[model samples]
Target: MNLLKTLAAISSMTMLSRITGLLRDSLFARAFGASDYTDAFNIAFRLPNLLRRLFGEGAFSQAFVPILAEYKSQKGDAATRTLIDHVANTLVWATLATSVVGIIGAPIVLYVIASGLEGPAFDAGVVMTRLMFPYILCMSFVVLAGAVLNTWREFKIPAFTPVLWNLSSIFFSLFMVKYFDVPIYSMAVAVMVGGVLQVGIQIPALKRIGMLPRLSINPFAGLSDPGVRRILKKMGPAVFAVSAAQISLLINTNIASRLGAGSVSVLQYADRLMEFPTGMLGVALGTVLLPSLSKANADGDPAEYSALLDWGLRLTFLLALPAAVGLATLAEPLIATLFNYGAFNARAVTAATAPLMAYAAGLLGIILVKILAPAFYARQDIRTPVKIAVGVLIATQLMNLVFVPVLGVAGLALSIGLGACINASFLFTGLRRRAIYVPHAGWLAFFLKVVVAVALMGAVAWFSQAQLDWAALRAHPLLRAGALFLIIGASAAVYFAVLLALGFRPRHFMRRAK
Candidate 1:
């Protein structure tokens, strides 16, 4: 597939999911607000979710996909087919064991993650964690299934999986929050149910494409397999790099929990908004680039590899820049307009806004890391990035300790921004030293263009924030969000128009089909 066409497909599917997630979170904010139980729920849910990303999605996918892609490339359909069965069955059994252990050991796990939030909050958190712990087993297999489909150049199913998570949570928060008067555990159930659906939805899609994977619990299929072993070897460093971000996030949570009763909720709320753009741009770019880049790197196509790296970076910055500006400039207006309803109040609004802006500061770094790290992974140089990533984690957590005492929870967001900046620097340095993906002077121009666009866009958002209809925000949230979207969108238009007038064609990096 052509670059833009492929990106559009991934982005469109991801957009559906992200939009649905926004609707879900809006409801969750109202239902739970920024309360102790809500804060506890965020901790409870994030613990297993954190591990899920660490081991399965972030760590495993980084390893699994490259190997699977290589298997398809060198060994052909039959070879890749068997490898998939071996990997899937092996992972399923492992995830099952982990989930069972997590379920039984929920209390200790909860305490380990968050010792500060005791009493009802801690108790509720443990219970919620127990309910959600098995999600690891359910979703770990989902990642394996996604790896299978992704190797076949199929991204729609995996991209679509997240939509269920958002929609299910939204449904429970809106319908059940009022009628049943249930605690946060109800939302936990929604998350677990979503995991089941996430994996289940992919099965039929895989079957339709003649890639439906079967699980037979084979430990030997991957044993000593050259490609698989290489993946495992390379995965060591990728885990370190990934752990940097994950560890930084956990530190942010850990610090946020100690701030006060609702600090964790505020940070989570802000972080989720930060995630929306990162999800839409960074993740979409990374996912699309990985398989293609792996093939190019494996084939030793230096020119194609550099060209693709440039393409990913350009798109990453182009989209990420404005989002950062928009979030930073309009944090309060956006939060007040969308989530400041029902249970979510003025206090919650005040708490979440600053951290969202803090996250905006490092938005570019966030996207750049996703764009560059894959270049190393494409070469199986996971250890280099991992070391750098670990350094970043240490620096960020240390900084969080110093800052959080004075800045409160917003300090955690600032530390996150710092961590991303460090991660990007390390990844870019490695990519340059490797001399595999060097850039032209045009990259500097692209950087300047993104900055100019965001500056112009931020100005427009600041002006429009005052003009927002408060009554509409209070009465019809969707309408208010639509208006807010339009305001920032129009601003983005002006910014892009300026960029095109200046020099950016938007298609130079994103080459079109003939």
Candidate 2:
């Protein structure tokens, strides 16, 4: 596959999904704003979303993709097919059982997730958690199908599938909310519907590939299957590693839950804004890199593996830096443009802005972790990341302790950024010590070019902010969006112009098709 082309395709589709997600969030903010209703929704939403990460994308994909890639590269078609059947069966059964327990134990789970909560926030959480728990089961199937397709080099379908989620939520928020007495409850129902659609959309793709597995519910079956056993083994360490990172976010949310109204909602809005770039670039790179890296490892091509890692890292750094700078510089405008409407007042925008900037501070580091963590996972080495994650978790909590007392939600965002830096540093160090990856030549010069380019971009943004009358822009929705686009366009132009002037070219972003 042309790595650049594949990355572009996935990135484009992810960009679409992120755009839809932004729209969905804007509607959510307009309808609910940074109130207890929104806070409760966010806390409730985080449960299934967190599980989706831990089980579906995090541990399951990290563990399953490499093994499946290995099976495809090394084993015959029949063997690969059989392995998928067993793994799919096991994954489905486990998720279903977990969903049942989650529903039945929603109150206790809510308490655990939110710590000190009562009244409407606690009640909404319990209701929403039960409503959304089945999403995990649906998403387990979606992830399994996505992994199978990804291993087959069918990247576009899975990349496109998440758009269904954004679309579903957007539809409900716009149209169906009035049908329900409590509109937030409509959002919860939208989530469950979205999960079903997310799974359904992948079926045709799986069928076309002829890799769809027959449904199975035999719980003990995978225990006796070799491929399933191997996946479960890898998944064990992966679960712990991914869980550590996720737990840090959960800890942040739990703390924010106790910080009074709008705190959780503010953090979530900031997080969603940060996710725009991270999803488009970071997630796109990781998805495309994993199978390629796994294939390289299976074929015993360490040179190719290292080169791919180098290429992904360099490209990620180049893009992520400018993104971080832009996000940090434009946090308020972005928040105001996208979400400062309806019930989402200027005060809520102000509340969310600082945290957005704080999250932006670590955007590059967070994206690095996204690309770099997969490197270790692709190598079938899970222990290193787990150890690093544990350390980062502890450090994150410590930072939270020091910063939260002063900065509030922004402190939580800062802690996460610090943790990301720690995670990225450790992953890079581990890869270097093992000689798993080697940085390309001209590192000093490359860093110089990117830094200079981003500096210019930041200057453009800073100057624009000072000159523009944001209050006037905010009063007119269309004007706000237009001005935002103009500023962003100018920033991009200056950044790219500087890069080109410093000898960076379009081809620099692409690796040779290998």
lDDT of 2: 0.89
Clashing pairs in 1: 241-386
> Could you tell me the TM-score of candidate 1?
0.95
lDDT of 1 by residue, 56-133 (tens): 878888887777777778878888877776667666777788888988998888877777788988988888888898
Clashes of 1: 1
Stretches of model 2 off by over 4 angstroms after superposition: 469-472
lDDT of 2 by residue, 432-507 (tens): 9989998879888999889999999999998897676664566799988988899999999999999989998878
What lDDT is reached at residue 387 by model 2? 89
How high is each candidate's TM-score? 0.95, 0.98
Please state every model's RMSD to the true fold in angstroms: 2.3, 1.1
Cα-based lDDT at residue 52, candidate 2: 87
Candidate 1 regions exceeding 4 Å error are 177-181, 217-227, 467-479, 512-514
